[model samples]
Target: MSVSKQADIAPTLRPPPALPADGMVISANFSVGGFSKRWNHCHQLANFLARYASANEDDPERHATLLSTFFNELLEAIYRNHGATGEIKMRFRKKQNHILVEAEVPINEQSAKFYNHAVQLANQPDPMAWYREQLEHDVPDDDAQALGLLELAVVYGSKLSISEPTSGDWLLLAIQFPFTEVEEL
Candidate 1:
């Protein structure tokens, strides 16, 4: 079964009162197996963030847009790999100052190749520029793509990082959204 982050904010977890802009905080995971294929986990998580992430009138819409991009693009990357393993794990976490979203999946030879290529493309000096260039010019035949990673960087201002191996060829991709810290009087 594929583990996925849920939209419901867990009861035990609590963060400081956000300035009406930060949305409710929660952490949950679901399986990504055949049964869960129809679910749009990303959108669920995104919408939750949209409603709760401290957002003003103007910011909510923008947050929704960015959150959508974040969820869609990350899922795109995972789907593009086309692996049979049904154990991918996706998470949405709120840190002291930022929201951390992540996805992890098992990698086969085909996915490993794609991962290497995509990582190389995404780790450029200016990832947004690279992503935009590819999006603007990417053809149907272009191999080894990571458009989702690019969109995450460009739209959400989330930094991408790979951590120590959790187990095997399981790849962990995480995006961190840092919130502005307002000093209190």
Candidate 2:
């Protein structure tokens, strides 16, 4: 007896699952390197800001404004001593509930050793003192200082650690923030 052969149908493929409704918390870390040369210093700072602008996904005008504000504050802090140059480039990655940012600061002849020294200071429990020392010369106004402190707390303060990666010339600033409900914000 010949049995009737029936074709088996294959199941359709399904798309990958989407991320949870909770939006991501983004972080950006930036730094400058090779600032020994007079012109390179300023260029580096400007470059870093430009990189920040480029990486931002939000409105260009808003991003530019944010960068400009940060740049002005940073410039006021270090212009006399470091004289910004080079570029500020940052790398970011998403963790469980937060994002990590790593920013690089160019090291010039005069600032090379200083940069390393700052890294050492960063290892301490309270690095705010070190950060303040770095900007003592600039003497930012009260409003500026308050804003700078707020930014530092919101951005870098959340970091659990800082390290020099084996693969790249970067001072890794790792931060994590919770993905909370809208009302929580």
**Top candidate by lDDT:** 1
Which window of ten consecutive residues has the lowest lDDT sum in model 1? Answer: 176-185
Please list the residue runs of candidate 1 whose C-alpha ends up more than 4 Å from where it truly belongs after superposition: 1-24, 39-62, 136-144, 164-167, 178-185
Cα lDDT tens digits, model 2, 1-185, are 86655544555454332433333323333333343335345545544654453343324354444444444434432332232454544444434543334445433444433333433444556666645654676644432433342344444444334455454333333323222211243
- In model 2, which regions exceed 4 Å deviation? 1-87, 126-156, 160-185
TM-score of 2: 0.34
RMSD of each: 12.4, 11.5
lDDT (Cα, 0-100) at 176 in candidate 1:
75
Mind sharing the TM-score for model 1? Answer: 0.62
Q: Residue 164 CA error for candidate 2 (Å)?
A: 5.6
Q: What is the lDDT of residue 64 in candidate 2?
A: 42
